[model samples]
Target chain A: MTSILASAEELTGGVCCGASVAVPREASGCAMEAVRALVRRRVRDLTLIAVPQAGFQADLLIGAGCVRQVEAAAVTLGEHGSAPRFRAAVSAGTVEIRDSTCPAIHAGLQAAEKGVPFMPMRGILGSDLALHRDDWHTIENPYGENDPILLLPAITPDVSLFHAPRADREGNVWVGVNRELLTMAHASRETLVTVEAISDESLTSDVRLAAGTIPSLYVSAIAEAPRGAAPVGLPGYYDEDTSHLRRYAELAQTEEGFDRYLAEQVIAAPAPA
Target chain B: MSEAYRPEELLMSVVAGLLEGARHVAVGAISPIPAGGALLARERAAGRMRVSILGSERHTFFTDGGRELFDCAAQGRIDAFFLDGAQIDGSANINLVGIGSYPRSRVRFAGSFGSAYLYFLVPRVILVAHEHSRRTLVDRVDFVSAPGTSPPGVYRPGGPVALVTDRCVFGFDRAAGRFSLSSAHPGQSVGAIRDKTGFEFTLDDAVATTAVPGAAALALLRGSVREALQEAYPEFAEHVLGQAA
Candidate 1:
């Protein structure tokens, strides 16, 4: 049975120091409230894996000194410009970066989803991205004539965290078109979700919602946190708080500014209702 | 020529011209110009062409998640895509990783998104760098996020076909692994482009001026294209396109 928690802090208790956590991109719902909870708890040495790419959430974790390493395709604040904290950390050599291409990250997670040891992929043959990753292997296709392919090992994270619009009483989360959350759940040891609301009705019972639902079998716990993906949008629910994000981008430019932001936003912030 | 257009409008026109005949074009994040171009091309195609802008709910149709775009590209479903880098060499090699050495970079740009894969799978991978300078258009990138050309025996059907910048257009030759000056943008001279470029490129004796966007194209861009582009890039639509549109 999945544990139904009352708040983001309680749900994030499972997240310990040095745990490998996989998170969704900005387009898909991000677990911002959980990130704040982790920061408030003063969690350290996290290995953050962006499920292809990330933005504000990744930068926040990096700035808060919660992350020891980052494995992602890219981290940028989009139109607001570069992710200042990530750039500063990378330049200062505070965080180890395992640079990856978008598809390679997906391939590795998919490999884990299928319970496979490795998945063979195309492209990345001559890239320095390939050269840097020792875990990635090149193998000749036994069935084809002189064809070489890249094999990526499974990427199974300790925890997969994300925000969603809703979850049912049965703990089935409605991720809608954001199917990467489904993949993340399957690839991680435990799946923790924070939702805008909890429905009394069973999601799997509804035909339309069932298609986009992540069954309770994969979910370890659920927390009810309204506006959980704030600053980042939740598609139909709300638009991205761009002004807030832009302000964050500005404040996160320097260590002093970042510490000020952490104190204002995460540490000294009001608890979610 | 009757109406003055913004530089972004010119760049969008160039991008739309490059996207002609592309059945399915996919634009990535932070690419308002390419997104506008793709939309403009779609309008021109009478909805025949499909344009998928990442992060746009109204534009993208990927229900299977993040990997579906890559999977679709691998299956040859995508005809055209766009990429940019911090440093791009003459051979079309892109450096999206950073400015300095690997691991410990002096300056780090965003890591490579899908460039390493889409640069190989999509038939037309157009490289767009709005900044055309010696620093961006380098002799050799410090890191190769995705190589412009692959060695023999590699199954590569896709690579950079053209490099578009603010000042000019450079057509890439896959066989020779080099770029040639195709056309110079309005007010930009061949001599000026040569002076600014850090890498060497073949220049023809008669370099033509890039065709200016016609009234009809500009009208479509300002009206329908800008309106549709707002769904994805409201800031660009509001600030860049402005009330004139």
Candidate 2:
């Protein structure tokens, strides 16, 4: 029974080698290369957890028919425009939407980080977001007067995915100020990271770098993928490719156009296994 | 007339005026105009004012992820912030979620980013809506992303102080639970505002025309402020400030 119940690496995926399952990040490098790899692999029925916000990653996943459900704050393209594929899927009722706010998602992630059931947060008192979300609850503050605040349940995703500037051969990933990536790694069962480059030296060699580094203990896999956050841009590496983003946005507005975009750019040629 | 300025330029100046002596001003994501205004305010303060535009590397001071903004607001560190809405009511209730009912809606705007939390914590929330018609301004919103006022005993340090629209400016009175017309732009008329507005608001006995941006303000906006704004909003810098998009 113990043998039947236990498979050591099964829970962790052994190493991160899959296509479409988990949604990627936006701020802490969106893992665009990983996303493209997933698109190529044509993985399906994904339950993506985009911490607070997501953009091209979500849109691409949705457009590629990989996402079944999305738990996110919002999926937008910022100044470019609304997320065409996400909007279409939600409107058509093809994908399940679990609308969340930034703080709520953070609180939920924090709860998972703390190994707690839930965390109470201020605000969301009279907002429609609170009204719609059943997973979130309003509770009386135990310490103070009849104060009611929102309590967000812990969100422990099956896998955490992100792109970082660099990773060491030791599997330690350097995430600088992107603390949410660290939290995501801590809370999730497994973290799969793609990096611009795998450093020869250990990231923990320097004290400053070590302070912002997520140890290999939490990271399940580190894939060397240069320009991993293309179009979206890594904070230090490059600026967002707005021209490409604009082109994608324009092409993604219509179903035929989006399909064409996927055929021409995303899945035109399969990613290397 | 000392060479006309664009409505956006005038509006940005008005927003900067509202940020008169703000120690720390934060502009939310997707808000280029407000961000530009905040940059102008920082310029006016001669580096005294700190403006944090979300999603910008140079602007934000938060290193601890997204929660720092909320923490700062709750701790009263944030002096001013900007919130936009698909629909805003007379009571200052802003609806950013969507049109029609909840969960399911006819149209969904971008989900409430941090309005619900920041509206309760920040001291001054300046509402900016590009469209100032009956459709945008409502007697009541289809959804309340963040209520402008809270019941007594509720810990609310922040609320709507004023709203700037394409046509006019309206100052909100939190105690009175209503908005009062502050000023209209040069060509905009009180009758036009009243006709276009969906919600009922108090009209001041002497509603002045919104002041146009002077040569100095224009220079600052087109020069330094615009340059700084390019980091966060490149399109805005190009569109409004005539910088390369």
Candidate 3:
């Protein structure tokens, strides 16, 4: 089955480009709203990953009962956060929370961006962290000659949703100086963007500098909406949403706690007018 | 006699001004100038200045790396905190996530650790960074790591009454929700400060530089860090505590 046992190269797109992506209801819709709509449709099997720094609203997915998994490489406990007592995986449909100082999983997507079989990384060695490998495997570095590195099988999400500082209606994106966003957009086959403002004018108006974080070609759809990363700053617009920070800090720490938080703060909360 | 003035000196000097009298404080990572300065002040001010090192992950420790700092602060003991943002916008919001695109971008620097959560409640916060530019200082941030001014009476991580940058020292104008130029260091100018920010600031005619680390305070810190570290890591003390001077 091409869908079931496809080679690493064939599957996945955006951020983790080796998996299937769920097309949006419309090619162009508000990025976050589209993500919300996607969650509403696949509430049972989905994993959400985004930096909490901008308060990207992971809580919303958790609330819809869609976030079956959380993924971050360098995970920390809450004064006493331990690994989840329950074990979950891609097949099992559980969220794997990965929090590392450097973006490893994101780099996995970058490896996919280059269409490579694996991405080499630093860290994750000399620690017991490599112990939990029921699925993930380590390889003897072919390039480094005997040095071993971990290969996170590239991840292509069902949908890669992002919020940018600015984007064009045709799905062309302008990310200013922050370019790793390119790796993110490239890592997914289908990418969705919610922007601070949309300019029908070519982004190279010369008034604003054009540093490509994501090219229009990579983006599947683009929606212009202000404060899309609201409560989090809009790049050049506003700062984080304090209420969200305060509420999330006080409430979400674990899977269940964070899930409950999403329902009340994001899903049930009134949409911005 | 007054001491000779410079940027590195002023960086440490600001910490002296902010922590000379505070009983307890937290210092974040990357820039260690103020942190090193504050610890020095406590030693000289009759050893009355009790400061703790609080890193981004909410990891609190002493100069010797003991976890006690975290324990004490968690128990509601820390009084002042210093932090930095990835992106500092118009409202003084911070974004430290990877630069470029999202989910898959070129460089994923470091993720935000508790700064957002910490700033919300810490009584005193001091925002610090070496440079403020059109990129660093912005009208708004792509991500909100920590905010200079928060909603009124809204449990704002207290004590962040001042912002110390390489060019100038600043504080928030509660009514305007923007940073006001407090003082430029002895030699620096406001124009120099404005040049580095990604966003604009309200600058007044008089700006002040940070106060220098007086002899007495430096001497106090010099002696204290050594004596304490001598028992734990003697070799490290010789390097970090400045062996001869």
Task: Give the best candidate by lDDT.
Answer: 1
The candidate that achieves the highest TM-score relative to the unseen native structure: 1
Candidate with better DockQ, 2 vs 3 = 2
> What fraction of the true Cα-Cα contacts (under 8 Å, chains A to B) does candidate 3 also have?
0.02
TM-score of each: 0.98, 0.92, 0.45
lDDT of 1 by residue, A70-94 (tens): 9999999988889999998998899
lDDT of candidate 3 over A99-177, digit per residue (tens)? 3223345555666778786665433332222333333456776665645555665655555665666665445677664
Q: lDDT per residue, candidate 1, B39-63, as tens digits?
A: 8889999878999999788888788
TM-score (C-alpha, index-matched) for candidate 3: 0.45
DockQ, per model, reads 0.87, 0.61, 0.03
Q: In candidate 1 chain B, what residue range of length 10 has the lowest lDDT sum?
A: B236-245
Sorted on DockQ, highest at the top, how do the candidates line up? 1, 2, 3
Cα lDDT computed for each candidate against the true fold: 0.92, 0.81, 0.50
Off by over 4 Å in 2: A1-25, A271-273, B243-245
lDDT at A182 for candidate 1? 97
Best by DockQ: 1
- Candidate 3 structure quality by residue, lDDT tens digits, B130-164: 66567676777654444556444333334356677
